[model samples]
Target: MSVVASMGRKEKAQGAEPSIAPLIELAGPDMERVNALILDMAGSNADMIPEIARHLIDSGGKRLRPLLTLAAAKAFGYEGDNHVKLAASVEFMHTATLLHDDVVDESEMRRGKLSARMLWGNQASVLVGDYLLGQAFRMMVEVGSLDALRVLSDAAAVIAEGEVMQLAAAKNIETEEAAYLRVINAKTAALFAAACEVGPIIAGSAPEMRAAYSAYGTNLGLAFQLVDDALDYGGSSMTLGKRVGDDFREGKVTLPVVLAIRAGDARERAFWKRTIEDGAIEDGDLDRAIGLLRAHGAIAETVSRAKAYGEAAVAALSATPAGPYRDALVGVVAFCVSRVS
Candidate 1:
């Protein structure tokens, strides 16, 4: 039976079974080093802006974004201080995006606590986010790789475009899978692709290897996002750092909702049309939407696609020489598709 048809019949975690433990083990020392650098970047300023920034940073996120950058660099055999600086910069870029996202989405809570916007208001959240972005750029420039700067800048631009695309897609119920991919690639995977690509580019690895990490990151990011979309319909608010079904509440047509709209029969279609398009979702809309998602097979379809794409991500790691870093890179495939939160 399709996963959608089997919903309410299966364990909740089974719906999105990504295992971060393996990824965490693989990250090891590098991950700890990552924490220290991020703390340094945020500093200890005792002000609302800094407090908001620090609050968000200390919210116990997985910190997978910059970890990918560092792991990819190490996999390519780059033993230098430059990657560390660049990795921190990349993380700042990601955190800045989150801060801005919360503000843009008008989110009240994050990681089970008040969001930066919730605590300090939207203006402070927006400006601090901008500060993080500026710091990211400043650090990137110091790395002295015009190549890195070019890639990161382009990624940032793409992220912005993707966010705009999603904003446009929010109220539109006819969103296609292609459009969905474009939005996610721009908003989330653009940086993932950049993270992996720069590893080899900075290390002076061959062109093929550079391309491999780039592809790997892109695929991993795609898989990651697909799982995330599914989880939004089911995962705990505390775990996802946002309320469950927040996307739906915001009028976004995620894969499940899109597919449900496409595959649902006449009556089901009307429900989506009313809820997703007409913005008439009510108190019980979440349960009803989950039912629609199952009826349309969108949930299972999304997971199937995530698994396939995750496999492709691991395959892209072949260009890296054999080693623990390579193994970790490859192992991320399992992590991507199976992640629960």
Candidate 2:
């Protein structure tokens, strides 16, 4: 059975699945300003910059990262306009990374559409990503909060490091779970942590509160990525925004593959080495890979781990005040993990 189908109906009905609508409703006004700022900043004298940038920007992503920034700030009673700027900066940073990532992964689709790299070419995609990064920094400086800038800049550096680490680990069947976690922590969770932390920083919240938001974002990001990894082998293309098995096709060593390799017999090990380590995937290979992942319960275990991270993310929010904002942030974590359930 599919992952979602495997879940008990009682679990699904008991709020095991949640909506981000609460977070969206709570941050409505600020998100409007953030959306406007994003559009304004995406503009440029050079036509191609905006063209390439808007193509991806216009694609219908949930804008969850920037919303996290806005919610964290509003949760702490921040009243300044700087939160808007920081929200835009977070989004630009995210968009820039997606642009670069598509190129790095040689991905052809994003958000159910052709990727920027597929249409604009890798050179243009990379350059426009650089442009977005420049704009992200400019907005960060405009905020004039050194703490926010430092957090975001540090995340940018760490994201680059994560990409490099993933590149090195790619197609290596021996990649351990700890090494995989490190890669995702850097590439995905770093930005999420920074995005949530900057809000509390700009609000001048207590150090403990700031740390709480950072931890929440970090755990939420881990859950989000883990779900994505599981969905790649178990979900539909529409839900994935790309083909299922794309990770397998690319020879990526995600958690499911790692676990399967550990539990697999000697003959199965040869199959993985031939397809992943050797990059010799043939027809019917993706089906075989998925079958093995299911046989070993790797996908189920990956989802279980994601649920643990989601629970940790919700726990981190206990440090924040109990209100609609905190409830909504908790909802965000549930929404992320629910994709698999």
Candidate 3:
């Protein structure tokens, strides 16, 4: 049977939320190596560099991106140690992005703790993020796969572009869904695509398999981000790892806001304008925003869109040979979209 077909049966039988534990288990030994490489590479004579990097790295994130890199490599029967290097590179890239994002977003919390910027200051955070990026590139070069390096390097540039795109789109109530998607595709999905693509590239797999992994990563990323957009308003602090309504407070024009704006009346539009566009949020504004999101079904719609992307991600896995690794990857899609459930 196909991987997706098997996944469906398992879901039906289990009738429970899908878990990432399987992927974690499959990647455990390699992940131990990846973690060591990360710590070793993050070290420097300038103690603050490792300090800042480790602060975020030690935070309780699931490390999903690097796991994807490792899982993708193993899925295609690769046995080389280069996958470990690539996985660590992917993680460093992700960690650097998070550090920079906290600085850009001016966020005070990450992974249920104080942000690196909050503790170390923005300059330290940014510089350390740059340091990590440099380290990530060095690791990529050590892998000796020009194709993998090119994919990851291109993703780095795209992630920067996406951040810029998001910055421009911030507080623009008129930002359409397409424009928002473009920002995420560059900022978030680009790295995911590169992380998964490197697996096939290192494995010397066919172009078709590489394309499949890229598609899976891209759709998974889109789904993941869309769920985050929904969770910002509708989820708990425990689930979000930050205070609820952070996006609304920060005037982030996520999909829920865009959809809410589209469906709102003139008075509602003015509310969005005053709060999101003009940065005039006041007491109870977040509650009002959540109410409007629910009233207009924006949150539900966002989750629905996320589910569509999750299905697309599962579909992309059809090209790969079926096994425990593929099954775990498919379960990951369910786990991502199931957060709102």
Per TM-score, the best of the predicted structures is 3
What do the candidate models score in CA lDDT, each in turn? Answer: 0.78, 0.91, 0.92
- Give, for candidate 1, the lowest lDDT window spanning 10 residues: 1-10
**Candidate 3 lDDT by residue in tens digits, 14-51:** 87657899999999999999999999999999999999
Ranking by lDDT: 3, 2, 1
Candidate 2 local lDDT, 206-269, one digit each (tens): 9999999999999999989999999999999988888999899888999999999999999999
Model 1 lDDT tens row, 1-341: 13222221233447643345555686667767766776766764646656776788888777777778888888777887667777788888888898888887777778777888877888888888888888788878889998888989999999999989988987787789899889998998899999888888889889898889889899889888988888888677765777898888877888888887887678887777787778898889889898778776778888887776777787777656999877666656665554542
Which stretches in model 1 have alpha-carbon errors above 4 Å?
1-30, 44-46
Model 1 whole-model lDDT (C-alpha atoms): 0.78
TM-score: model 3 vs. ground truth: 0.97
Candidate 1's error at 116, in angstroms?
1.1
The model with the greatest lDDT is 3
Q: Which stretches of candidate 3 lie over 4 Å from their true place?
A: 1-15
TM-score for each of the candidates: 0.90, 0.95, 0.97
> Against the correct fold, how does model 1 do in TM-score?
0.90
